[model samples]
Target: MPLFDTHCHLDDPRFADDRAAVIERAIAAGVERMTTIGCADTPDAVGRALDIAKAAPERITATVGVHPHDASKLDDALFAALEAAAHDPLVVAIGETGLDYHYDHSPRPAQQAALRRQIALARAVGKPLVIHTRSAPEDTLAILRDERARDVGGIIHCFSEDAPFAKAALDLGFVSSFSGIATFRSAEAVREAARALPSDAILVETDAPYLAPIPHRGRRNEPAYVEHTAALLARERGEAREAFDAATFANALRVYGLA
Candidate 1:
């Protein structure tokens, strides 16, 4: 079955020299669709993501928002640009937003404020959200609840939280996206959580140019490597690879409103 990489950053500078080759490789590897995210870390990040998606509209889509790392930089002008990017036919979601206390690149309050604003934008634009939370589950869940994120739904991208947290997110109508981290031998906890989640509430991503899966563990990641992560997740869930692929592809389309 064909595969889908639900989250990645094709606009990362690491992909600059061979962006086309990377996309082509992903397609050849049976990665039927990809969603490249624009965290608005830099001035041109959103445009870069859109251009990549536009280059292959049928097989790729893009998202726009400010990352928690850049939370302090977010302002009216930036949000306006993000909202404008969301209007593009190729734009399918409203983030890579949420709290990231592990890095603490931005202040905690700034991260919270940025997350809330993006959640509101997601609701306002009627699009699903793509969240990133690390070392801040309580605050993440609380803010999500307070902001009524359940109404619009979204994915907990690269989920690393425990089972109860995953359950809480599921209860709030969010899907958990497993990344290459789930394939790591050290990630038994993550695998257990993936195994415990409802099949329909699960998804897979690469978070590429970041967490490269086992075997490729020390190398740079790209969309084509998502198959490796998906394969491992399929095995952990005890579903046939084909079945898992179809389910995740459907779940992704549904969550992103592309179905």
Candidate 2:
């Protein structure tokens, strides 16, 4: 079955030396489509994400938005710059932005503001949003509802929330994307969350270079590893691997808005 890694960070410096090889390995492993996220306001990072998409337009695509950790950097000029790049023929979605109260990397207000602005941008540009919410599910849901994120639709990337949160997100027209973390033994609750998700709302990712799953937890992650996550997700749902793979792949396509 064809695989779609709904979220990854192929632009992270970890792959600078052999990004092409990474893509090749992904394709060889049946990952036909992948999205490398760009921050809403980080020009340099987003710029690199675009170039990666441009270099392999057929396989790699990207989304531009300010991540919650760097939300403090957003400004009108920054959004304007990102707006200009919205239709660059590479950005497929509008965010990796939202609340992250856990680290408080960026001020909560800044994160919320950046998220709201990107939600508007996504609506304006008719692109989906890629949300990154963590340890602040209630506030994230509040903001998403306030901004009517359902209008544009998107996925909660690398989701680690509870079943209720997942259900709430699904109720708001959002798809729940599980990452490599779902494959970890300690991630039992997360696996249950994945199982509890409606079939159509379930998608998968590697979030590479970040949450590598079992068998490769301490090592670097890549798109190819998404398959392992997918398999684990399939098992958790009590469905056949091939059937779950096909269903999740379809869900990924729909969330990505791929034609």
List model 1 lDDT by residue over 1-259, tens digit each. 8888999999999999998999999999999999999888655565778888988899999999898999998988788889888888788888899999999999999999999999999898888899999999999999999999998999999989888899999999899999999988888888888999988999899999999998799899999999999999888888999999999999999998889
Best lDDT among the predictions, by candidate number: 1
152-255 in candidate 2: lDDT tens per residue?
88999898888899899988888889999898888887888898887899988999878888778999999998988988888788899888888888887777
Question: In model 1, which runs have C-alpha deviations exceeding 4 angstroms?
Answer: 42-44
What local lDDT does model 2 show for residue 182? 91
Tell me how many residue pairs clash in candidate 1.
Answer: 0
User: What is the Å distance of residue 74 in model 1 from its true position?
Assistant: 0.3
The lDDT for every candidate, in the order shown, is: 0.91, 0.86
Instruction: Estimate the overall C-alpha local distance difference test score of candidate 1.
Output: 0.91
TM-score of each: 0.98, 0.96
For candidate 1, the TM-score is: 0.98
Q: Which candidate is the best by TM-score?
A: 1
Model 1 worst lDDT window (10 residues) = 39-48
Worst 10 residues of 2 by lDDT: 39-48
